[model samples]
Target: MPVEARYALLYSDYEVTPCLRIPFEKFAFLILTLPLCAFIFCIIYSVLFHFESATSTHCHVYNVLPSISAAIGNFSPQREVWQTAIMLQSVPRFYIAVIYLQFHHAMAYPRDAWMGNFAFLLNVTENISLIILSFWTSSRHYTVHEKAFITFILMSEFHMLLTCIMQSRFKRHNRRSLKWKRRLFLTNVSCIILGAYCYMRHNSLCEPYMYSLFAFAEYVVVLTNMAFHTTAYFDFENKDFVLYKYGAAITER
Candidate 1:
């Protein structure tokens, strides 16, 4: 069967203007903004109100920024804001994952289609792990939260790497956006390494500002990850998210 015939099976022959249609750019904006605002809110709230606990570590080292868990785990409004953001963002994220899978598979060709699908799986697992970690705070469900966080980090890093690799293979696939995505992926990986080192050193020596370095690195990792996702805006620049009634009459404009 032809591709058009396959698509036709999913939709009716009638034509109608969508009741709700949002451009991918606008949708991507929401995807980018929610977490960013939550991150900023949680960090500022932690610094201003929950300073001692937020920046504290096992070794009692002084810190500049709080770890993501510290900022959003135990706090009241901070936790709530973070949870709300994640919950809201999750729906669009799943949609974006499906879109990316199709986009990658179609553009990269069937020979490497498995890579695209695997990347999609990684994206979904990463999102699920994020949701798990957001709800299960280390202060409470320590083991569960820790495991979820580790999974989230691993999945997120690998998803970014795989996505960059897939994009690099497509000769005409938005080279400028791919350029920034690859750059951000490298920076994200660097921050992850730096954060790990700082965390280990802080625990071993109980240094004054080592935990701060870890916190800063963690923040950079998050920022770079967000920036990488932001490239999706360019990826689907002309696309629209539509919700239309399938059998509705086509009214003349």
Candidate 2:
């Protein structure tokens, strides 16, 4: 069958399903704002404890801008603050995974296409990997932490790639506003490239600046991921998911 016909059948099935649908705006807000706030809090928390006059001499000046993971490690004297910041960050990640899965459902892509389902899977996997890395301090579980970090990066990139592909196929009316999507895609790709370079420089050359450079790259990656979700605001501005009340008829708002 033609792609349009397949999409039509899938959408028809979605229309009859008795599940509650949420507004994409809600998801977009969760995806974009929460993470931004959480990261900002984490950065501030990290910077404050890192530069304390009491600890600065023992911790070294370079330690002031340690990798985000290092800043949030369990060994910090401010472990509680760092852990709290990490937990706050994780909330948005969890919500992002949920929103991506919900988005896949809302799109009603055919099973055969599989891109939507796979994108959700990758997104969830990325979140899980990050969660693992967050709690499993690198000082104690270096190998596991490193593996989880790498896995998160790989899965996140794959998730974004699939998202870009799927978004490109949006109905004609929605595709026009996706110019920003292309720019975001490029930004993501550039971050990955720059991040890889910085990582290599830090590991191979032991360059002092490369450590901070890599950390900044990681921050950019997170920001770009958040930006990717912002594109949905344009695509779903007018459409909303219907919420079904328990023991009551479904109604669209």
Candidate 3:
């Protein structure tokens, strides 16, 4: 029997009336848009009012734009706004990660399910790391923030790569979602490389706008990461999140 068939059979005894139903695409859109807007707002706020503080580096020179850490981690309204946006999105993202795990398990072979599970673990870890880094600013708790940031980056990259590999193994999966995910993943990798290079050169030579270029690269990395996740919208476009009351089954003689 197929996975869906088995799932239906196992739950046939329960009374499954949806108390709440939400389309995954809309959920995805709201969550992604929140952070994007927050990021932009923080950047603008930093540039407009806190220009010297936002753009100042350890070398006491000003870049064109602030690094994400400086923009959202060091300021007043920016920090609060960023924290709020991330907090709002975090729960939904966790739910989505669980849904993706179930999706992979249902669609993939038994042996391949392990990869899905690992990817799911990575996704959860990445989310947790985001929370840690977001709440613990580098300026305040440098050690915690630095560690969380590193973990978030590592987990995110691995999770995306594994998700793509797992989906590619399925011949009948959504080609459009897979294609776009692969492209976004490549873009993210490119941004990472560019960001690293710019960061290195900035520290070594403190060239004009070098740190700004690194900051811009970091922005692209974030955008691409979010875009890659938004592909989940296509994957689960037709799906609805249904909630059922427990122990509500009825039988008539």
> Which pairs in model 3 have colliding backbones?
none
Displacement of the residue 47 alpha carbon in candidate 3, Å: 0.9
Runs in model 2 lying further than 4 Å from the true structure: 1-27, 52-64, 74-112, 239-253
Query: Best candidate, lDDT-wise?
Result: 3
Candidate 3, 182: how far from true, in Å? Answer: 0.6
Q: Model 3: runs farther than 4 Å from truth?
A: 1-15, 243-253
lDDT of 1 by residue, 125-177 (tens): 99999999999998899999999999999999999998988888875689778
Q: Report the C-alpha lDDT of model 3 over 224-248, residue by residue, as the tens digit.
A: 9889889987777675544345311
lDDT of each: 0.81, 0.61, 0.83
Which candidate do you rate higher for lDDT, 1 or 3? Answer: 3
Taking all chains together, the TM-score of candidate 1 against the true structure is 0.90
Instruction: Quote the positional error of residue 126 for candidate 2 in Å.
Output: 1.6
**Superposition error at 212 for model 1 (Å):** 0.9
Instruction: Report how far residue 140 has shifted in candidate 2, in Å.
Output: 3.0
